[model samples]
Target: MNKKAIVTAGLAAALSIGAISTAQAASKEKCYGIAKAGQNDCANISGTHSCAGQSKTDNALDDWKAVKAGTCEEMGGYSKAQAKELLKKQKEMKG
Candidate 1:
């Protein structure tokens, strides 16, 4: 193939890789589930008490987004794996 065609193909491959990486990152954020949150309340799910001073609704997925990285192993809420993801999602959403 001509240099121009080769360059185009390379660019397309790069773009595809970038898109896949982004999606994978997004999926990782969901690793933390209700099991980690302690309770299904999302807010209470965090063990760090980071959400202590915040309102109840802030932890909602549609609210302020993300959560503080409390105890990833869960204390008052969530399971180990679930809490881990919740913390990640909480941080991502917060930003």
Candidate 2:
């Protein structure tokens, strides 16, 4: 294969992989209080950090990870409302 053909093929493959991940994410939902330390998919509810993989505590009520839709409860994860409530209580107790 020529260099141009190889490059085009690689680009096509990369694009397809991106599309696949996007579709997978569309089928996912954020599950709170389940991420291990430094494994969160995004920022926590407490606003301590503004990026992924920044959680300082394992299974922090404020931290979350993406899980398959409808499976978070089975994994003992909390919904956004529940996590928020739990974090609120945790903060109050610490003060």
Winning candidate number (TM-score)? 2
lDDT of 2 at 32: 100
Question: What TM-score does each of the candidates earn?
Answer: 0.34, 0.74
Model 2 spans > 4 angstroms off: 1-19
**Model 1 per-residue lDDT tens digits across residues 8-70:** 999999999999977765554221332322233223444434442343432332212222345
lDDT of all predictions? 0.46, 0.94
Q: List model 2 lDDT by residue over 1-95, tens digit each.
A: 99999999999999999999999989999999999999999988878899999999899889999999999999999999999998888889999
Q: What TM-score number comes out for model 2?
A: 0.74
**Model 2 clashing residue pairs (backbone):** none
